[model samples]
Target: MDEETRAEILEATNRALCEHGYAGLTVQRIADESSMTSAAIHYHFDTKEELLNAFLDDLIERFESKLPCGAADPRTRLDGVLDAVFSPKDPDSDGFPVAIMELKAQAPYHELFRERFLDFDGVMRGVVADIVRDGVAAGHFDEADPEEIARLITTMSNGAHARAVALDEHPAETRRVVEDALELHLGWTPGEEVDG
Candidate 1:
C-alpha cells in the first residue's frame, strides 16, 4: 500500500526471483523472502501474475531512471547510456538481470509478458536512438540512421545479457565487447575524455 511496504514487497520478490527464478517462484516463496505472510501478499496482489507484472513494471522503471538525460554533450550521454545497458556483472549474484532473462524466455508463451517485452524493447531502443541522433548532430559520429543503430545496440545488449546469463561470463567481457562495437559504430570510445 505505502511506498515502503511496496518497496519491501518488490525487494522480496527480487530475492525470490534470484533464488528460485520465475519458473520456481510462488506466492509463498515471495512471502517467505519478504518475511510477510502469504495473506499479506495476497492483500496487496490478488494473484502471482499480478505480482510479477508489478515486478516487471518496477524493474523497467528502475532501469529507465538510470538513463542519463538533459546533457548537452552526446559522447557523455552515450557513454552513460551504454554503461547502464551493458553493465557486465554476474546475474547469478544480482538476480535482477537473470530474472529479466527468465521473463524474456517466457514472453512467447505468455501474451502479457510478450507485450511488456515489446514495450521494454521499444523504450530501450528509443533511449539509444536519442543518443545516436545527438551524437550525429554534434558531429561526433558519422551520419547514419539512428533507429538502425539503436536496434543494433539493443541486439548487442540482448546478446550480452544472454552470454552473461548462460555462460556465467564476467560483466567486463560484455562491457569490452559493447565498448568496442561503439567505437566502430559511433566513434565513441569508452573512458575517453570528451569536451562538452
Candidate 2:
C-alpha cells in the first residue's frame, strides 16, 4: 500500500469511528469520510475488523511517540504524561475519546482489541513505573513501591478517560484526586520543590 493511502485510510477510519462508533462503523462510512471508494478500502483492508485493528495501532503509536521520553527529570516526565492525558477539553470538541471507549467496551469479544489495549496499558504502566523509580532514587518520592504507584496512577487515569467520555465529566477532577493521592503517599506534589 502507498504510505499516503494508508495514512488516508487510517485518518478516515478515525473520523468514521468518531462519527458512527464501533457498532455502526462500515467501510462505506469510512469511504464517505475519505476520497476513496468502498471498493478501494476493501482492496486494502478485507474487513472492517482489520481496518479497526490498523487504526488502533496507528492511534497508540501516535500517542506513544508524544510521550516525554527525553525529559530532563522524572518529575517533569511524570507531569508531562499526566498533563497530556488529563488535559481539559470540551467533551463535545473531540469524539475520538468516545470512539475509543466504544471500542474498549468490546474488548472482551474482540481479541485483537483486547491485545492492543493491553499492550497500550502495559507500556503506559511501565513508563510510569520507570519515572517513579527514578523519583525514588533521587529522593523526590518516598520509598514506596514504584510498580504499585504506577498501577494506582494509571488505573485512575483510565477511569478518568472513561468518565470524561461517558459522563461528560471533566478529566481535571480526577487529575486533582490523583495528584492528592500522590502527594499523600509519595510526598511528591506537582510543581513543588522537593529534595532531590
Candidate 3:
C-alpha cells in the first residue's frame, strides 16, 4: 500500500470515528469521510477492526513524538503534559474524547482494542514516570516513588476525560485538581525553588 493512501485512510477513519462513535463506525462511513471507496480502504486494511487498530497505533506514535520537546524543568514538563492532555480535541470536534470513550467502553469485548488501550495507557504512564524520575533525581521533586505518582496522574487524566465527556464536568476543574495532587506528591511549586 502506498504511504499516502494509508495516511488518507487513517485520517478518514479518525474523522469518521469522531463523527460516529465506535459502535456506529463502518468502512463505508470512513470511505465517505475520505476520497476513497470501501473497496480501496479494504484493499489496504482487511477490516474495520484492523483499520481502527492502525489508527490507535498512529495516535500513540504521534503522542509519543510530541511529548519530548517540552521544557527540561520537571515542573514545566509536567505542566506541558497536563495542558496537552486536557486541551480540547480541536476547534470543531468537541466529540473526540467521547469517541475515545466509546471505544474504551468496548475494550472488554474486543481483545485487540483492549490491547491497544493498554498500549496507549502504557505510553502515557511511561512518559509521566520518566518525568517524575528525572524530577526526583534532580532534587526538584520529593523522594516519593515515580511510578506511583505516574499512576496517580495517568488514572486522574483518564477520569478527567470521562467526567468532562460523560458527566458534563469542566475539564479545567479536573486539571486543576490533578495539578494540586502533583504539587502534594512532588513538594515543589513554580518560582519557589531558587536557581542554584
Most TM-score-accurate candidate: 2
Q: For residues 50-144, could you state the per-residue lDDT of candidate 2 as single tens digits?
A: 88889888877877886887555888888887877788864554788889888898889989989989988888888889888898898878888
lDDT of 3 by residue, 43-86 (tens): 98888888888988888887777674645777677766776677
Worst 10 residues of 2 by lDDT: 187-196
What value of lDDT does candidate 2 attain over all alpha carbons?
Answer: 0.86
TM-score against native, each model = 0.90, 0.92, 0.91
Off by more than 4 A, model 3:
190-196
RMSD of each: 2.0, 2.1, 2.2
Q: Pick by lDDT: which candidate is best?
A: 2
**Candidate 2 runs further than 4 Å off:** 90-93, 193-196
CA shift of 76, model 2, Å: 0.2
Candidate 1: 10-residue stretch with minimal lDDT: 86-95
Which pairs clash (backbone N, Cα, C closer than 3 Å) in model 2?
none
Q: Rank the candidates by TM-score, best first.
A: 2, 3, 1
